[model samples]
Target: MTTYRFSTGETIKHVVLILGALVVLLPFYLMVSTSLKAPQEIETNRGGFLGQQEMMVDGDCVRQGNAEEDCRQRPVVYNYTQAFEKAPLLRYLLNGVIVTVSIFIIQVVVALPCAYALAKLRFRGRSLVFGAVIVCLLIPVHAIALPLYIGLAKAGLTNSYAALIIPWTISAFGIFLMRQFFMTVPDDLIDAARMDGMSEFAIVWRVMLPAAVPALLAFAIFSVVAHWNDYFWPRIVITSSQELFTPPLGLREFKGEMADHAYGPMMATATIIVTPLIVAFLLAQRRFIEGITLSGMK
Candidate 1:
């Protein structure tokens, strides 16, 4: 029989990790809980997780002179319903999908070729260029926000999908990550493709791309999550156009727009916005970990 025992340090480390996970998940828990609870319960902090699910009158329905019974709904139903009905939440979700997808596609298109060149092809100033990419990773988006906004504004691209996606199209981190992963790919593969008379571009698209799927998936998670949840950049550029607003910007609907803050609907909106990301990460968890581990193998 096999015996298993954890050392004191290992046990402590596990405990700390569990505590950290709880801390990170606490806000998400509250968001879902609050969305399920009646407003009174939320105010009183009375409902434990999942809430009592008591029936609540829809204030808007009542205000429209509907009968009280007709307006009544369980807290969960009311919150999630209002999340979609009260604002253009679906439109915002669509915008998020558009921006994230566009940015990721463009980033991959740019990054893959550059990464292949940097990884496989020996050329002058290659080290300097990669070093510059490394330097770019150190520079936060906030540092360049003003200049980027100004440039976009000068080009009359603000308040459009272009504004949301163009600035993010050239991702230094994407380039660096793909470059690292490509470095681990065997040189023999590229040589074999060349021996088959594949052009450089053909080699990148046909040869390198297939083997880089895991790494691409890893980068996709990063790119998609970052752009999907981005509020700051969207808020800056999409001031007047609610149609252009992303999921994060859609949350502003519940804040400062009404006399009583609609915490339930707001939380519901947040839950919807984050659900896709959570689902995607869960599905790709193994591949993501594999990509990260293998990317550094070279």
Candidate 2:
């Protein structure tokens, strides 16, 4: 009886979880579906899914020839061609890659050391500083945008990639994450490395870094995703040159210049913009999950 009850409980839990996952995934499914759909189908079909709710205009569609066109499906490839040829899509992608990689690399250099210091070294105002970082995590980027922009302008960094990349190199959240992961590292390990004639820096590089591989990788993914998907900062800083545009900005330009309200090309541009992030996640899925799951949790 107990075994049957356990099996029943497990089955119920899985069914609930699967439903929840589907619910969460529905929006993404729609985005991809609509992007692949013909422009006419998008206008006519109030809801794309077979059994989804939609507003019915009681024969309005049938009354006009456009009613059929509204339900007409577009060839997905044509939308993509229009999206790409209409804008500097390739330049946008290259610029995005450069800025995103720069942000993550610089973040690692700044974050890792500060994280190590907070984790291992004894110092004055340490707890206070840690508290400040935690507080900073609560603050949104928009709150600081104006001041940051002014400072960058004054420092002559405006209109440069430095404007986008430098200020973000030292992330307070990254420090918190690294510190939490480092705390889990045994103190004895550091001491042994010291006894073996390893300096503090050497110990950090040789001992702790190797030990913190998962956490580092986790942060790298987080850093890449955050910066790569971000469009606002790039929009603000990079204005003069089309060459500096990123994927998101490029897609926006495509929509603005060519579409004027054309949904097919807009959808195609969106699909192109998101493809890299999706591919990255797919390829590094295990590492990304493992890193986040274990880091700072214990």
Candidate 3:
């Protein structure tokens, strides 16, 4: 058989892609590897990729009046166990789920109707409203954080779940994406629903919402990921409330409370926090890509 050969351009492209993949994956590799390594191995940077897999004594456990024999564990076990035990990680995860889901649901509820109106309804100043949405997209959240926080403080919504969920309920990007996708739907569908005596509100829910699934899925991924990984806003709003801390904020608080050398647990916590988004992306990757692509076609 003849040897397979790639063109020079193909070879260069493959090389470039490989390099890019490596660059992106490097931090993930380090995070997992460091999480597996013992404190000594991490400090010395000596254990290689899988780490030594050696039994390590947990100094903190020993100091807590536990027997030395009980304190001895594999580095992986110690790191992960401490990550959960030292903090209310379960509560933090629950709070993350609650906040992320609540934000996504409210965003969809508020955005979908607005998007339908923008796409299908002919009303005065509709163009102005669409322009306002586009302009809001251009304004970074950080620019208005001070005013938002001040308002929340005045309203006494700070230090609660409302603080985390309320500010993010209205997603301009969500409205824009959904609106663009809705614009692509044939007008005949809406006319048919009207012919069947469906109210505009009924048509919005029954006809438009289902048709916009791809875009909604895409927006869901965006909304969930953004809120899930959001530390800055949560940290700002959720002051003095450990019970309401999201995963990122909990991880931050965990780091602050840990000793300087708790890299293993810290890395483990980060890995845990990051894993859900990775899993979600992997599972719905096809839908996610299709959604983004479809939304952009209009």
Off by over 4 Å in 1: 1-23, 123-125, 286-298
Q: Scored by CA lDDT, what does every candidate get?
A: 0.87, 0.75, 0.89
Clash counts per candidate, in order, are 0, 2, 0
Best by TM-score: 3
Per-residue alpha-carbon lDDT of candidate 2 for residues 145-168, written as tens digits (9 for 90 to 100): 889988988988878878878768
Model 3 ranges off by over 4 Å: 1-3, 6-17, 286-298
Which candidate model has the greater TM-score, 1 or 2? 1
Scored by lDDT, model 2 comes in at 0.75
Q: Rank the candidates by TM-score, best first.
A: 3, 1, 2
Q: Clashes in candidate 2: how many?
A: 2
RMSD of each: 3.1, 7.6, 2.6
| Model 1 pairs whose backbones collide | none
TM per candidate: 0.87, 0.73, 0.90
The lDDT leader among the candidates is 3
State, as a TM-score between 0 and 1, how close model 1 is to the true structure.
0.87
